[model samples]
Target: MLPKHDVCGEPLYTPKIIFKEQGETKYETTDPYVWCRKCKKYVEVEVTQK
Candidate 1:
């Protein structure tokens, strides 16, 4: 999912690559939390493929 601003209306930190899996197919997963500088905490989010 594309990163979006936090609830405080501040831009979130860039999504971090958590891991990469390789098997029949190769895909990388990103961290579910979007860090907010103003909030000083993480906002949970779900990543999905369009």
Candidate 2:
């Protein structure tokens, strides 16, 4: 039988809004809110220092 992903593997989820930015590129967060996983949103990818 096939194994359950959420139990044996990684849980399915969405992306988040909060992310990084760099020069002209953007790196959106894959899980910012990290609430229900589905609440996660995403923008363009970026790069910067905290």
Each candidate: RMSD: 3.5, 10.2
Q: What lDDT would candidate 2 get against the real structure?
A: 0.38
**What TM-score would each prediction reach against the true structure?**
0.55, 0.27
Extract clashing residue pairs from model 1.
none
lDDT of each: 0.70, 0.38
Worst ten in a row by lDDT for model 2: 1-10
Clashes of each: 0, 10
Error of 2 at 21 (Å): 0.8
TM-score of 2: 0.27
Clash list (residue pairs), candidate 2: 15-40, 15-41, 16-41, 21-46, 21-47, 22-47, 26-45, 26-46, 27-45, 27-46
Which ranges of candidate 1 are over 4 A from the true structure?
21-27, 46-50
Per-residue lDDT value at 2 in model 1: 43
* lDDT of each residue in 5-33, candidate 2, tens digit only: 33234343333456588888888654432
